[model samples]
Target: MSNSVNLDDIIISKRALHLSENSSLDEMADALQVQQRGVWPLYDDNAKGLEQVQVKTFHYAQCNVKVQFNPARIKSSAAKVDNKSIKERKCFLCTDALPPKQKGIPFNDEYLVLVNPYPIFPRHLTIPRLEHAPQFIEPYFRDMLELSRALKSYTVFYNGPKCGASAPDHMHFQAGNKGFLPVETEYSKLKATTDRKLFSNEHLEIFAVSNYLRKFIAIESDEMTLLQTAFEWLYELLEQRGQEPEPMLNILSGYENGKWRVLVFPRDKHRPDQYFAEGDENILLSPASVDFGGVCITPQEKDFKMIKAADLIDIFAQVSVTDSYFDELCAAYAKRVVE
Candidate 1:
């Protein structure tokens, strides 16, 4: 059986790029500056059967084989911005004072699912916080515990307010279905490499996958102390690294192989939404779900846009451009502290 086999017994693989040999990446990115709307279905000609793919900015949907673009669906993620839009940056994630909102899954005290009108995905969801506080995943630790416990089947992730959050005001989280990621499986099967430091005992269990680009973790165990200890080790490392110096960070976490996994994304500077290349006022262009998932989408239909998925993978591996600003800080601190 071919690896491309799906439920329908169709085997598919990488087909081809959307642009021609003459098309340059700069041209594609320049085109995105003017307009941001583009997507193309992919097919594997050598597959056993015909498998058509529905490519989104963040994901590829196919019955037979999964597919994604190399760079990005669009050239630039910059978006138009205005004070009016900025002023409206209320932390809607934890707006319990509001009413119960629903997108796909039902709402609970811990977390609620709401449709993000200005979404990268066609039906993107915003997991809001009930406390209505500044955006931070640790504050609502129980929420993550409950949300993950309830939505055991889903993939939950947290992008630190200063890292990749579009709204850094209110604290909230995100959850989506499984199988949307490429490395989710590969990460699961990954054995411990020499770079990792395992922390496990009767009470505390923590394992950190210390490679570049992707972060594999084993966060959950039968014991709660293990989780707490793991979190502490992670936080201590964060403290040593001085990640607090940064304004934000991007993070991706999910469950597979019967354990939890986490990847710490980084950033270089605190840039506003304009960095994304949105005409008016929107700053984006870094590691994100669509980018990591090898798919991406743009809601705006002003011009033809296309996402390069392979670009995302490579970009993520460049932690300084993506991972939280902890590695350099911590590594330096360790050197200073020891020296």
Candidate 2:
């Protein structure tokens, strides 16, 4: 739309920039020449479809997170997996969150607080289901216990799978460092939601508008039971809502001051790294929220300059529950349909 874009438009916009994996700020400055796009986009050819980033800082950006695949690759990966292991397999999480210490008091009909084994952040924990089922806003209980700590002053986080998860399986949630993304942005914005009467959890926030493009944030509760019950209804609805589910989902939660926040992202975005996939010449397609927002920091300049911002967006958005991934996901559900 704006001429602010360059000839390569997708790959390298006029403001386009790249930061190789594990790179420092100085290294980034040396490569950009102008030394600062302030906020630039990111991508991975290793990725299969539309996915890019928009970030405010480069020097401090970890750059450790990189996509390893796109939907095509995801489909391929899913296809290659041995489905024969279907029935006898145990949920990895149930196995790992083992030797259960004292379980916290159950919060709602479907939700409960439990310890997370492979934590992404400190006190990494989960607000999962008591029945062990899958749901999209899963791992996310509208706003569960892992809240108070994900605030900017506390920690940062990255959700995967359903909302950006590497482990699309296992019913759980995670909270981590404030380095990349603080957990409070969603919390402070809760009061701004449209239906103020909806939440009773007292901690859930609600947005008056869809805050981020394709992204909506809110926390609501009419009462603890209302919050819990509404979610129970949501759980029943999710059987038809969150595709096949891989039979599970995870949420990246954050917050502070008694309130909780969450980002219900989709995971199918992670692709294996090129080195991890095939050879040194291979590329990885790891897409993050920053990339979809417009600025992505890739380890290679080519990824930043190769795909168009719009192109990446189109692909990433498809993973939304309302999109085609639903068709593929639902088909999987149909197969597992219980008689």
Candidate 3:
């Protein structure tokens, strides 16, 4: 992948919005509307796909999860992320490879924000780096925070290369409308009820949440530096557990009222055994940040209709770290932060 592609070749002048440190939510909302209207035919078709989408909510003891039967997401759900497959295919996220009808808003001179055609949210944006790079969060976690703040109407999220990312060869972050995910609305109550405080300071507070089907660490802060430091620390700790290239994780970040809330879901595997199972036992689910956040996407209508709450519990358990490991991680994190 070459970084020599000119920005003008990809950006539609009329649709492009200037994003900066002081960009406002209203400005982004307007830009998104303009872009959608500018690419009317494509978005209009995607709107029809959205209309076909169906949802079913399963109630759990501590929380509820919505399973969406979105047939348009089959490409992403069944993506071949293996090295050979990735090498043979073109990176769809690259500037030159983008669809002819697609237009983007230039952000911070480094990223381009484009509307997602196969969307789970009513308003979804995929932000990819202008330069082609591998998916890795260590170097760009700060960028995620800034994007969440600038795109205040959206929640910014990352899916690890080996986990949920379809274009693992390209570096990207996705943003969807705020309050769209169940976890966003449930976080405050979960924090007060089930989350165990791991660390706290004047600028940052960290908590480990285990009751949410999947185990995860949550960091809340009004300061970017503190948030970055805490995230990097957690990344290092997870890395020490021996995953190659990078640790397996998915993240969801949101900014509101001058504060940033980041949820990190560490994974032990990409997909559960059910994904590879044959015949009637098979499921096509590939869990990602959104899935961990409370809405799981099922590309096959049969899988969606047949999946039960017990299946969800088993799937989450198979992909997430064990309860004992989570306990140890919490203890270690608490001790390390105080030191």
Best by lDDT: 3
Candidate 2 lDDT tens digits, 188-291? 44344434222232344333222232333233443444444433443454455444543222333444444444333433334333314444444334444433
Q: Give per-model CA RMSD.
A: 15.4, 17.4, 2.3
Better of 2 and 3 by lDDT: 3
Clash totals in order: 53, 72, 0
Per-residue lDDT, model 1, residue 337, is: 30
TM-score of each: 0.55, 0.42, 0.94
Per-residue lDDT of 1-339 in model 3, one digit per residue for the tens? 356666676665532555564656536655764566556676767667887789999998878899999888899999999999999998899887877777777888989888887888888889999888999999999999999888888999999998899999899999888888999888888888865898877788899889789998999999999889888888878998898669999999999999999999989999999999999999999999999999999999999989999999999999999999889888888887787
Task: Score residue 141 of candidate 3 by CA lDDT.
Answer: 97
Off by over 4 Å in 2: 1-164, 169-172, 182-205, 208-211, 220-230, 246-250, 265-301, 322-339
Q: Which ten residues in a row have the lowest lDDT in candidate 2?
A: 39-48
Candidate lDDT (C-alpha), each: 0.41, 0.35, 0.87
- Misplaced by over 4 Å in model 3 are 1-5, 13-26, 37-40
lDDT of 1 by residue, 42-127 (tens): 21111111122244443322111123322233332432223365366543443322322211223453444543333333223457
